[model samples]
Target: MIGRPLILTTLVVAVLAVAALFVVPRLGGATAEASDLNLEAQPRLGASDAPVQIVVFEDYLCPACGQFAETVFPRLEREFVETGDAALYHKNFVVIGPESERVAHVGECVFREDEAAFWEFKRVAYRSQEGLNERRALDLVSEYLPGVDAEAVRTCAAEDLALEAVRSDVGTAQALGLRGTPSVLVDGSEVTATYAAVRTAVEAALAAR
Candidate 1:
């Protein structure tokens, strides 16, 4: 499911991330301890017993996040999430602006009705992120989630459901010392922000298990 534009940039991001590691501040020293893993806060996308956990923090408006969702995410789901090797918990980190939180709130509203809807919104919103703002965030939900109560989602989004949890996610990212969007912590260790690197880390975690 990797698109042409995404494929062109994945490796480039990988290379740059490796080079930037030293320059970027390493917050919690690259390891999120298992005891510190917060599964209760966000929507998790994998089985309970999965040996590895890929905690995702990203903004819907972030382009690097779109690239990750397009290129690395499918493979991760197929080889890890579906196979019960690793779990993914996508947390909201709205660095773009208030609009990012609005979109996240819509996702929260959808999650109340259907977990699947929330995931779908994440995908579609990212694909359709161009020119998106607080107002248009609701429009994307209406267009994409026809089956769900779009109006309710808009209401909840305006009210900002689970807004504290989004703040918590931001704190988690800060503790990890993240430098940018589309970052992952594989088994509590911060790897290069790329699917290939994450997959390799997951394999290592699996082998260790």
Candidate 2:
């Protein structure tokens, strides 16, 4: 009887060890692998072959995200994206509310139709972020993104045509265990969401490359 109890305890320990091997990686180790990010069919700024890849996780309704878009993004665009040192990709992590999801859907629709106009839509969304709602966001897109098909964007948002893409972004953010807006990743490592930190990380990645 003693030998049988000891054998059962050993088996239980072995089973837990195997289970942890699979669970631990999903919890933390996956965050370090940029390859895990789903970048396919996503809007990107800068050269495709840039040495460093920068990913920005944001929510449209988040004020901090708006601040980053207005203040830090331009510098990043001029210094890194334009220079071909890095490619920046935007991903959605809709944490605010229903309004945020609505905006994200519209943004994805614009991205699918015209990649260039999507950036304009982003700018206008943040510019008019105060008291923003679904109707205002769509109207802003119509007003600011002249190059985009306004009717098509409206229809797409109403029909939730781009919902899958937005959901994919949300899933990616959740998988990485991110819990906030404006999370910036440089070369697969999380960095402080500031131009100075981003610049430093980009430089370090470039130097390492």
Candidate 3:
């Protein structure tokens, strides 16, 4: 008993609403909740079956991310990730520029080569980010990942696979409504990307479990 005209009007309104939703958030430098966030293949540390999942969306060149890595990550690794209470994941949200994106791409390659090396790569990247050059990053990566092939990494990082890895990560970040680097999401809920917030959330999640 639905009239054609009524059906058409409803569809139009629905389309407009969806369009508006996408437009509104971008105007404020914020984003709508991301669609289809898959953390399965992302670089992770700690046990896979950990009760709490702490995901960080960050850029290599972001100073805040560096601060989080330096000030908070060690304690996090010790208190949660190392203890097997929680797993930490890094999702590349490359927004800084070419150098940042390049490093992100390299990070993907590093993670693929050795999951254990990814953590150190992040640590070294954050520690000596004053240069932020792609060549410098590659060199640092080699230094941290000694067995890794710098020339091979240079080739792989420039390949489509590496580009897509970082691109996909950035897409996931956007879908999660991340506004800036060092965004930590616990159980799909965005939390402050800080040691205190992450620890509290992890403890709470563990307690609840």
Q: Estimate each model's TM-score.
A: 0.81, 0.84, 0.80
Candidate 3: regions farther than 4 A off = 1-35
Best by TM-score: 2
Please give, for residues 1-209, the per-residue lDDT of candidate 1 as tens digits. Answer: 88978977998998899888965665443677766657765677888667888988888888888899998888889889998888888877778887777677666677776777888888888888898666776787788887888878777777876567677777878776776788788878878778788989989888887
TM-score of model 2 vs. true structure: 0.84
- The whole-model lDDT of each prediction reads 0.79, 0.88, 0.79
TM-score of 1: 0.81
Model 1 residue 157 CA deviation (Å) reads 1.1
Error of 3 at 167 (Å): 0.7
Residue 84 in model 2: lDDT: 91
Clashing pairs in 2: none
Sorted on TM-score, highest at the top, how do the candidates line up? Answer: 2, 1, 3
RMSD of each: 11.4, 6.5, 8.4
Model 1 segments beyond 4 Å from truth? 1-29
lDDT for each residue of candidate 2 in 62-132, tens digit (9 for 90 to 100):
99999999999999999999999999989999999988988898999999899999888888899999998
The local lDDT score (0 to 100) that residue 187 gets in candidate 1 is: 79
